[model samples]
Structures are given as C-alpha cells and as structure tokens.
Target chain A: MARASGEAVLTRAVRILAVFEPDRAEAGVAEIARLTGLHIATTSRLVAQLVELGLLSRLPSGRVGVGMRLWELGQRASPTLSLREAAMPFLEDLHAAIGHHVQLGVLDGTEVIFLERLSAPGSVVNFTRIAGRLPLHASSSGLVLLAHGSHDLQERVLASPLERLTPATVTDPRELRSLLARVRRDGVVITEGHIHPEATGAATPVRDRHGTVVAALGAVLPNDGRAGGVVAALRAAAHGIARAHTARTSDSH
Target chain B: MARASGEAVLTRAVRILAVFEPDRAEAGVAEIARLTGLHIATTSRLVAQLVELGLLSRLPSGRVGVGMRLWELGQRASPTLSLREAAMPFLEDLHAAIGHHVQLGVLDGTEVIFLERLSAPGSVVNFTRIAGRLPLHASSSGLVLLAHGSHDLQERVLASPLERLTPATVTDPRELRSLLARVRRDGVVITEGHIHPEATGAATPVRDRHGTVVAALGAVLPNDGRAGGVVAALRAAAHGIARAHTARTSDSH
Candidate 1:
C-alpha cells in the first residue's frame, strides 16, 4: 500500500465522493478508480474506509453508493437550503406575480447552480435541473452572478472554455467581458440565450448587507418580447430577498 | 498530537464538520475542541487538514466555517435533493390544491429531518425548519418513517428519550409503540402533535421501486377539525412522488 499525505487523503476522499452526480448515482469500485484516476488498491482501501465511516454504503448487489449519512451531513451544511427557506414566501409571491418560471440560483465554479425553481402548470419547458449546472455566459442567473463576481473570477471564467449551448450564446471573451460590465451598471440581465430559443429571461442580483451579490433571482418568459414587466418583477423580488436576508441576520444576532 | 486509526480519523472528521450547524456556522479552534471533547492540538490539526481539502474555510475574522466546497460535495451526495427535484412538480400541485404547507422529510438517525417544504402565504404557522430535526414520536412524517423503519431503528427510538414538544406530543413509550403500529397498517398519520395545537399534519410513506420507504410526504393544515380531505391529499401526493421517483430512475438508466 502506498502512503498518502493528510491532504492527499482528504482530496482523494472528495474526489471519490464527487463521482456520484445527479446523473450517475451508483458505481462499482473499479469504475470509481478509473473515474478518479486513483490506483485500484488505493481506491478500494479509501472506499472501504469511507464505508466504515458511514459516508458511503454498499448495496446487497455489491455496487457502492452514497450513504444516507453523507446526505444528512450535506443537508446540515446546505446554505442553499437555508436561503431557500428564507426566500420561499417571497419566491411564492414572485412566482404568482410573474406567472412563469421563477428561479433562484447561486454561482458555483463559474456555473449557475439552481437552488429553487417554481413553475406554473403548462409553463414553458426548462432544461435547468435542481442541483444541476449551467454555463455562466448562457443563462440569466449566470449572467447576473458573473457580472457581480470579482475581477479575478471574471478573468478566470473568460480564460476557460465557454461551451455554446445555442447559436446565440456569447462565446467571445471580450464581448462577454463588456456585457458583464453593462449588467453591473444596470443591475439586471435580460437574456434570450442558449437555454430556450423561444424564451427570454430577466435576472437581478440578490445582495447581502455589505451589498455583495449572494445569489440571483430571475424569471423566464416566452420569447414573444414582453419582458419589461417580468424584469421589473424580478428586480423587486431580488430587492425583497436582500432586505429579508439583512433583517434575518440582524435579528438572529 | 495523538494518532487516530483510519476509521477514527474519518469519524473525527465527520464530528468536526458536524460542529458547524445552521445556528452555529462559525467557530474558533478552541470552541470546536470544547464542543467535540477533543484536545486543542488534535482539533487544530484536523481543522487544518479539512481547510486544505476545502471542506472548511477560514473566514476573514479568523473563525473557521463550512466551505462552499463542502456544500458542493454534499449536494452531490444528497438523495433528498434528487428526490426533491422529482417531487417538486407534484408538491407544487398539492400545495396549490390544498393551499397549505406541503413538506418532505426522511429518517435521519432517530429523528425526522425535513428535506423540502413548500408553503404559500397565509398558510398555518408550523415550526418545521428545512434540514431541522423532530422526534419520531412527534412529527407526522416522523411517525410514518418510524412505522416503516427497521425493527432495530424502532427499538432504538423507543428505548431513547422522547421529548414532548406540545401537550399532544406522544411521549409515552407504550402509546407511541401502538401509534407506530397503527401508522404501518393505516398508511397515513394524522396528528396534532409537537408543533401547534391549531395545526394538524397528515403524512404518508414514499416508497421506492423496491417498495422500501425512502421518504415521507406530508401536509400541515390548521386543525379546524377537517382531517379527512387533507389525509386523502397527502396519501395521493406520496403515491405521486413514489411514481415520479421510479420514472426518474428508469429515465436516468
């Protein structure tokens, strides 16, 4: 057996855990080793350790899967869940007021990870998945988060590969840089980008007490060009969320 | 510093992470050591290892807090997040139909941990928090889970202390035992327990394809003495969630 540093142990544990995504829930030890590029013996040993800790569990059929213990720990640490709880009443109002797809998202590694979404019956179809990722340059919430993100983060994202989900997606780094600047000035983003060719979305940044952008609240409408009202509603909802966050924090302390 | 076994190291790591709950998000090294009953040196070393792995992060004010990386990894492993995604549509429908608080919870340890909750404005005020825990003998979802839980789990919860949250809470072990039996045979739990005297909740078990209870779906309503309609709606919604879960798994595979 090979000896690993304490840091290596933690990193390997995280890598092993990351192999289970929304699309892929279960995997065999050999598959995990291949996916994580760890030696088979090292992978198996670490996995057995995790199973012992109750962070992972093996099914009777022999495939290893994420255990309920991991889920419980994650649920405990989820700020997204807390934010959703705080914003639910306001989100419900926004959803009813807008009568479209209402979503809340936060920036995660240059992508927008949706925290909550409310859609009406017979609303436009959306590809966004809960706990799923979307390109920062393509979605409305992503645009808002990217615009408010730090300069270094913006540059890092621009330097990375920008996947074009639709023909209208802005893949040019320079162009996206300027667009983000305009979004910062306007405090809103109205996009008809890659997600739904026949749909448009308006997003606004939800801020904290120090005026830092924490998340984005947005609404998606059909691409028939009636977006001004939806944009106003989204901005109001975002402002309300910021106010609620401030109030809750102040009261808690 | 004292050395720990591989299993001990993993358990210690989990204990360190568990110290940062929703209420206590940040703490210093000494505080964590005191909370977990570990030596200061050992706690500091473990915290450093976790920070290096991005599971914990150092705040600007010098306190340690749970990191976004931890949140990301946890989100990946969360079965509740996946189930919530599948059940959101149905939950929304049920909430709309009933105009009340619709919630989803799962068994965690000896308590019921709320996974997701959807409530409209003017709904009954209940003290259920997302990711918060309630005793198995008190909450409606808790009862449903306890009824369907393994025999060991039942014995463990029964043998432990059952705190009474309200006058109506079933703290008597004998009574709780009979209630669990009734819950299993009836397939639903309608109770005015633990939360409020004015609120009644009806919960039903959500089964996976294997017919094992994976979760409990319930609705909280004002106890205006109308329980029959709410009970029927909760059972239907639970069935809907189970069907959706099966469909989602089949589609993913």
Candidate 2:
C-alpha cells in the first residue's frame, strides 16, 4: 500500500488520540475506526504505529488507551507548566481557606480552558474540570479573560452567539460587553449561578511581568452571600500568582 | 520528494516532540533539526504540520514550543488521571500539614515517574518535578514501588547496574534486596539524601481495590530528625488515597 502523506497521517493520529475521552479511555481498533470514520485496516495500521511509539498502549483486555509516554511528553514541556506551577501553591491556599473549588484558566480561542483545579470533598458543585472548556460568556474565568483580551478576541466573542448555560448566564451581547467593561474597571467578576444554580464562580485576571493577562484565578463557591469575601481572596491569590509567574519566568531565563 | 513511511514519520514526530524540555521549551527549526538529526527540510515540514495539528505552536519570536492542545489532550485521558485525582486532596492536606513537598509517583518502566508534586516556598531541597523521573534505587517512591513490583521487573532492575546518586544511595545489589524486603514488610521506605543531601524522601505504597500497589505517596523534607512524623503522615495519606481511588473507580465503573 502507498504511504499516506506525513501531514495526513499525523492529523489522523491526532484524531485517533482525541477519541479517547476521560469516560471512554480504552477502545479497540474497530471502535477507533468507527469513531474516526476510517477503514478498519487503516485504523489497525495507525493504532499499531501509535502503540510502537508509546503514544497508545494495549490494555490487558486487548483494548488501547492513551499511553503514559504521551502524558509525559505533553507535560514535560507544557506551555502551561510555569503558570500552573506558580499558581498551584496559591490555589491550594485559597482552596484551603475557602474550602471550595479553586482553579486556573486561560483563554483558548473563544473559550476558557482550565489548567488546574483543586476540589474538596463535599465542596460546592463545580462544572469545570481540569482540561475542560467553557464558553466565554458563561464562565467567570472566561469573562475575566475576555475582559482583558485583545480587541480581535473581544470582537470575535461578541459577534458569536453567547451560549447561556444557566438562567443567570448573560446571553445578550450588549450586557456582556458592559459586564466585561466592569470586569476591566473593577478587575474582578462574580457570576452567581451562571453555570449552575447551586454554584457561584468568581474570577480575577492574573497578569504577567508585562502586565498582560496570562490567566484567570477563580473559585467556585456555594451560591451564598459569602461571595463578598471570596472576591477579595481571589484578587489576592491572582496577585500572588502573577508575581510568582514573573519570578519563575525570570529564574528560568 | 517521496513521502516518508508512516511509521518513520511518526517516530520522527515523537523525536521532535521529545526535544522540547522544561527548561528549553522553545526551539527554532534549525535547532530542532540539529537536535533530532533530521534533514532541515524534513524538520521544517514536520514542524509546520505539528503546528497545524496544534501539537506544537509557533511563538511570536518564531520559535516553537509545546502547544496548549498537547497539554489538554494528554491530561484529558491520562492513565494517571484517576490516581492523581484521588490522591490530590490527600496530597494537599499532607502538604498543608507538613509544609513541605508532597508528591505522587508510579513505577514507569525501571524508573519512578512523578505524576504530581506540591511544593511550598522555601521548602526543603527537592530534585523531583511533575513528570520528572528518578532511578528505582535512589528514590523513596521508587523503592516502595519496586518493593511491590512484579518479580520479573524486580529481577531486571536489580540485575542492572544501580548508579549511586549519593553516598546514601544503596547501590550494593544484596543490600538493596534486603532493603526492598524491609520496605515490603514495613509498607514504607525512607531515603536520606539519596537524591539530594539537604532533603529526605519518605514514601508509602497506595493500593488499589485489588490490593495492588498502584502508586507511592511521598514527602520531601529537610534531612533532619523529623522523618518519624513524615512517615506517619505519608502512610495516612497513602491510605486515604487508596480508599479515595477505590471509591472513584467504583463510581466510574
């Protein structure tokens, strides 16, 4: 058989890897072929190649799952490493003090992608998980990121239909634009029941040495009137994260 | 030009990704070509394709670094996810109580690969990082894992030359065998200055529902006379992690 183009093969490999989600981490060649819409033979060949490279592993049950080597390589030089490292101590502190869920998020395209999350047993309900994504208008982290984002990003998000995750989610473009302005002016956002009725998300922008927003430090708390104290705590943690990131970046260089 | 074999191309892609390290995250095409020993044209083409696949990203400085998508995908369905998640809360509590470096590690091949580490400012000197590795004989986590590892794995590792990382590192095969026996009997191991003179590592095994040692919960602390407290703390945390993992696994299944 003729070899596929290198680019096409790599793209297909990515598709194969992407099919393994948290809930469905293992798949047989047939399942992979069905998921990726490739022929069974092609899927078998690709899965074998991936297994050879340690990007996928065969389970004892003969199914394949994401390999540890892939996780190692992805983590060894992850772009979010420095930020996550810097933010972790502070996130832990905030999580301990607030006894809820604390997280760090960054803007990826028009959505907010969480880099880290710390949760306690019986903490407030949190919809966001590590490596999870949320719409720009529906999450407080996304709101903080969008508020400090570039003009192009702001326009792109504004032009797109805002997904309303809950009744409190701001779906109107004009209201969102003004809310973003307030986030910029006030430097913090508190969304009550924006993503879930039982939870509240409060976030503030974390800046770098150049004063550019690099991430959002947020907390998910019970939808109680206790958000007043959380905003101050979130701001403090965000400030600490920014300073820590700057120091870490300087040390690395 | 003829396209490379799919297997060769994937191997080359793995090599390219492996070249980026925590300290040296970004590299230009020339440097990547030099590092991977690939033709400059081939390196450039593969890099461009990786960028398109979002496995690598081009920085504003024109150098490339591991992309956000790579981190996201690696974390989404990592084999370590369930273990890490189950251990995180316990690790945090231990970190808070000990005010030192708390980590979770699993035996990967002949080495111990840390899946998570929590460190405090001005904490004890620790040589490990998230996704970092240490030899089986020179780390407390490694010793704990090796103690309960498969007989074949144990024999192979023992037969291999054990590099002495420090004066305290047990390099004598007979002595190491006895030490492993002690670890198995005691359910914990402590290494004083095995990897760093200023620090000590103490670890205990975390078991799954089947009572298999799945991970090691450890702490890096000052090499003072305080290992007693740390050992108790490590055991407690390991027990908590194992129970949490059992619960989580059952829930997921």
C-alpha lDDT of all candidate models, in order: 0.82, 0.92
Q: What is the TM-score of chain A alone in each candidate?
A: 0.87, 0.97
lDDT of 2 by residue, B99-199 (tens): 99999999989999999999998998898999999998899999999999999999998999999888889999999999999999999888888988888
Clashing pairs in 1: none
In model 1, the runs with Cα more than 4 Å from the true position are: A96-100, A119-127, A159-163, A195-199, A220-229, B1-5, B96-100, B119-127, B159-167, B194-199, B209-212, B221-229
lDDT of 2 at B93: 90
Best model per TM-score: 2
- Predicted candidate 1, C-alpha RMSD: 3.0
- Worst 10-residue stretch by lDDT in candidate 2 chain B? B225-234
Q: What is the lDDT, from 0 to 100, of the residue B113 in candidate 2?
A: 95
Candidate 2 lDDT by residue in tens digits, A82-155: 99999998998898889899999999988999999999889988988888999988999999999999999999
